[model samples]
Target: MADSTGTQARDTRLYFPHLQTLDETVRFHAERQPQTAAVRCEGRSLSYAQLHQESNRIAHALRAAGLKPGARVAYLGKESEHYYEILFGCAKSETVLVPINWRLTAPEVSHILQDSGSELLFLEESFAPVLEQLGSAAPRTVVRLGATEAEPDSFPAWKATQPDTDPAVRVTPDTPLAQLYTSGTTGLPKGVVLAHRSCFAIRDALAGENLDWIDWREGDVALIGIPGFHVGGLWWATQNFNAGVTVVSMPAFAAGEAVRLIRELGITTACVVPAMLRLLLGEPGVTPEDFTTLRKIVYGGSPISESLLEESLAMFGCEFAQIYGLTETGNTAVCLPPADHVPGGPRMKAAGHPYPGIGAKVIDDKGQELPIGEVGEVCLRTPARMVEYWGLPDKTAETLVDGWIHTGDAGYIDADGYVFISDRIKDAIIVAGENVYPAEIENVLERHPGVAEAVIVGRPDERWGETVHAFVVAAPGDRPSPRDLHRFLAQRIASFKLPAKYEFIDHVPRNPSGKILRRELRDRFWGDSERKVN
Candidate 1:
């Protein structure tokens, strides 16, 4: 399909054939498309030249603040144009950017900062309370995005002191660019180190397939509602910025605000989780008219319910694509393209095909490849796969084997090469596209004084693809109210990780090896559902 500019959107390879690195992409646009809009948020916009200059200043500022190459710097804020500046700046300075989830509690935030060994921190003013709660535990050098008198060190003021000249630091495509944290089976978060190559590996792999749904075109206005902390949010913004398209960033997603932004900005394309789509549809004033300019809506992070997909296909009247990957896989290694989005069709149940350069295989318990239609561990080999789990060589060795990532997901590849995900080999629940590990929640619940045992599981929810459900055993004669547990967990973890539903049980089921029978607990909630996951 030709884009608004009458350019063949499918001919992307002809346009962006040599964007090898993030800094190179920025420089390419600044030199050739200086006047084009690069990013926009909350009514503010930055052109390519302006973005390049500001990031140059940020790179200098970070360097002056004692950050050297390979140093980690953390940012705790919602989506914004400033965040992209920091991202690019980090690339220019050869520093690694670590974005922490704003939804996490003070302790949770502190843990990531400490774990990453980040010396500098950038945050939004709204998170001052979390910093205050952290006290001396917070990072020593903090710069507030929109600082007030009370908050101090404003990001604008800091950038003004630095030179607006490029650092021109030497960095390779393999240089680590970002560290994204994901919950491990042990309940602690592990930092996934992404390299410059990780960001563009998938794009390079898709050079031949000029899928109009993903191709960038002049005059394309993209709406970004996802948080910048997750790969989905960070990569979406970078992808658009790299293409020199205008990106409208939503600080945080709200059903009403998202609808308003889509209408007001005339967003031509958007990438969202199924829950975001449902929320937009549920908004009272939203209609087909609101999304008229929206040409494509890409979703992933969790399987979309058939009902929601059908309703969305009818309501939005836009092309749909489903991306499948993990933070450790850069972003997308497999995609269910628009052509396969037929409702109720057999392909609808599949996760779509792997990208051209991605290799996917299902393996049995003995580590042998499984035949078609037999479910087993899903393994993926792609250039986009992460270099390693930061500072954990042992864990990295286990995950990355012979250049192939052993994705802890169970699925089967059909005769047509379509991949169908049956369940998670790892006990991770995806709530609105965010991965929530059961062990993380169980650790929090079992800590409560009135709780003797706890097991967390996922249950189907219409809005969020799946919400956390907890089955707990109270102490001898003590009853732990849901309200109390909620309050306790609120101070310990992110709100999204909290249980939406709770049940009191007399005993917690476990195998002889003392491993929690998550499948058994999940079965109680999932009933006879063929797929164990939502």
Candidate 2:
């Protein structure tokens, strides 16, 4: 372990090199909790022992499908027990697993599948339609979500009747675990290659730490109520499981259904996004008792309002820990401790000090460290940093400089070393607690026939913290209503990311460099405002 002073421990002979492979973690749990509940989905539970055996069989099937050690296999499905099995199975077999977002469109999903160089795709029944036209998309084998066919074909399921044995391939710590595609503010989405050790280290850091916010007890089941495609949802699930905790999961976030599951399963811990948190909090007849049974609730995405936080603290009768993290760090590098949730808390506005074993510093453009209370860019150096941006060497270099992943958040560190997020350096908006890049919105808006050029910005919102606003230049002859614009955007992009306000602009301010002066449009709304949306 490194010293707390951020120096290498040369004098100590106990050199704990981080575990580099995902199989190592799976093996550790398989032996420790063979019969313990490892995963739960839609009322079905799989014990750790059973999970290991199933993954072994899946690994064998993957090899039978002619997959090489370093082959990429995208798991295209919803939240389910089989999801993790496929992920860990790929890890055990030294294969890269890419779990596609169920929310993405057919074309969007195709781009990720093509970029990852996936040779096989394991999709659920619901997503079967999207894979219908993937002939030239790069996968030789397409595995269905259900039972296996007697004869292997282009699309088959080999997991049902396969035998369990040791995976033939061995992977090192640096082995790539996934190629998750996230939208870049500059242009198209890029694949972020995160290694097994990177994410596992994140979970490992949270280990044994007291979760005062949530009342986590032995044998108490938690809910994996989010999609598996995002880093947070997936890693948090593994985090609880690494410690032998039970987890009940759903396909996606839904209010009434999620409440039912929590109550019915007697779930103790739940990881939620701000939007869903609000939805659940707004559920009628929901009182302190409704969520009180839950020991703790962890929420992030957007900064929670004071009112929401207060209600959660009182209603849950436990701590409400708010986390601040990025996918570039493979899920989390910082978490607001439970103790910091109460009144007169230290670093109340800032996400609590960096998690144990992780170091964060605020630096200026020149990379010089800034003083506490000074706003600067937040940079992170930790075991959980992603390996690189796949197929984008230049972009990767610009992002990860000198072992520090540049988190493009404009924030400050307090005297107590607590980090406070002020604004995102990139023109990205957090709507309903989900990161929605302006570039993505612009791309979709520009596709409209009556739109010439579109620029998207964030507007201060009381309910959502920040809502997307679009300024567009009309084409030949047009007068688009706000409702028409919203409906058009709703058809192209996710409903939550559509522009809430539309402005007709004759010209967009651009500097000599031809870069759109987004700051100008942003200033129009937030100039007289007191604070930037966190």
Candidate 3:
């Protein structure tokens, strides 16, 4: 183990150097630390050996159910040991796991199921009504996640009948391990198909660098503060597991519960969004003592305000690293190390340097690389980039050029190679770490009878990075109340995507080409902030 000063130990060793796939990480740990706790969630724990055996059974059950290699298996539930069991099972069988955000509305959920062509779905019992609403759109095979072992269609009972022996299905590092859906500019969600290599690529790169921006040590207990559906949460969990460390899963992020868990579980490390850090700090009765065991905290998903960062730094009293990346880039390619996390440091405004093997550059509209200190689209070239955006070849071609993933973020790098994010090139709003695209919400709002035209813009908020704000042009002789519009949109879109504030306007400003001048409307709320994004 490395010492407290981040220096490498003389006896340093790679945990599973020979492992080529994600599932093999489980086997490697189980063989060495069978009795060690792999995961603890909801008052239940799974040892490494138990997790390996149960995942093997889950793999056998998938094959028994006639799911061929590369079949999409959907999981619509919160974080749990069962989720990882199914995730590894899919990896072992060479199947793709599609994790649906349970917060999405039925129609949104139905679209993902249809787009992925998932044959089997494992959902929590609480979300059964969502599946019911889908009816014919739902998969043919649906299994309840939490049920007694004696229950007929419960996940435990279903896997119990299957043999626990390893199926030993051939899988490679390039095999599609997960298909995570991210909202697109086209008013629909696009599936980001990630391969097994994403989980290990950055880790392997950091091994030779000896930098401890984010390191995992034995006895380290990591908190999965974000939902597992997002790439941030999935990647964080895999990193800890790959290091053979115990992970504590939160079914859903509750600030009060997170505070309690940190103290009770003696969590040593955590990866959370900025919004979660705010909530954890504001949780009633929370004190610095609650975070005594925390050695490091990794935060990203949205730009954190300076005030929050300073407050968090003083409170948590741990090393904080800020990560920056998109789902298309396999989560994090750039990390703001703890050394640069000074209160008023010049690099505090920057998003930090890239990993050892990662490449980041700013490009002009013509795809020409820009000189340092010039703001443009930030592009990243990493081994962890997604294989493709599912089946959309044209979209894949547009984003992934050469070996670089063109992140739709406008940012510049300094002479010292520090990345400083300015604003978003893509007109997507991030609310509490959840991606909300204006096109998707505008599509739903325009369908309302009283709404003639609708435009969505992000309004910076202190709590959530940004809140959805809508500008509407009422139909002739028709005026709709915010309450009425909220009700209409609530049923059609996810709650997080709903507009928090609305304005009645005569016309929406647009250019001659009829493209919505979203910046004009968004600028009214931003005023003169240094960074357009919160």
Against the true structure, whose lDDT is highest?
3
lDDT of each: 0.85, 0.75, 0.91
Q: Ten-residue segment with the worst summed lDDT in candidate 2? A: 7-16
The global Cα lDDT (0 to 1) of model 1 is 0.85
Off by over 4 Å in 1: 1-14, 148-152
TM-score of each: 0.96, 0.89, 0.97
Worst 10 residues of 3 by lDDT: 5-14
Q: In angstroms, how far off is 108's CA in candidate 3?
A: 0.5
Residue pairs with colliding backbones in model 1 are: none
lDDT tens per residue, model 2, 262-319: 8877877888876677787788887767665687777776777666677667666756
Error of 1 at 232 (Å): 0.7
Model 3 misplaced stretches (Cα beyond 4 Å): 1-15
Which candidate model has the greater TM-score, 1 or 2? 1
Error of 3 at 368 (Å): 0.9
Per-residue C-alpha lDDT of model 3 across residues 1-534, encoded as one tens digit per residue: 545433245634334446668788898889888999999998899999998999999999999899999999999999999999998999988889999999999999999999999999998999988988998889989989876778888888888788878778788889999999999999999999999899988887777686788888767899998888999999999998888889999999999988888899999999999999999989988889999999999999999999999999999999999999999999999999999999999998988899998999999999999999999999999999999988899999999999999999999999989899989999989999999999999999999999999999999999999999999999998898999999999999999999999999999999999988999999999999889999
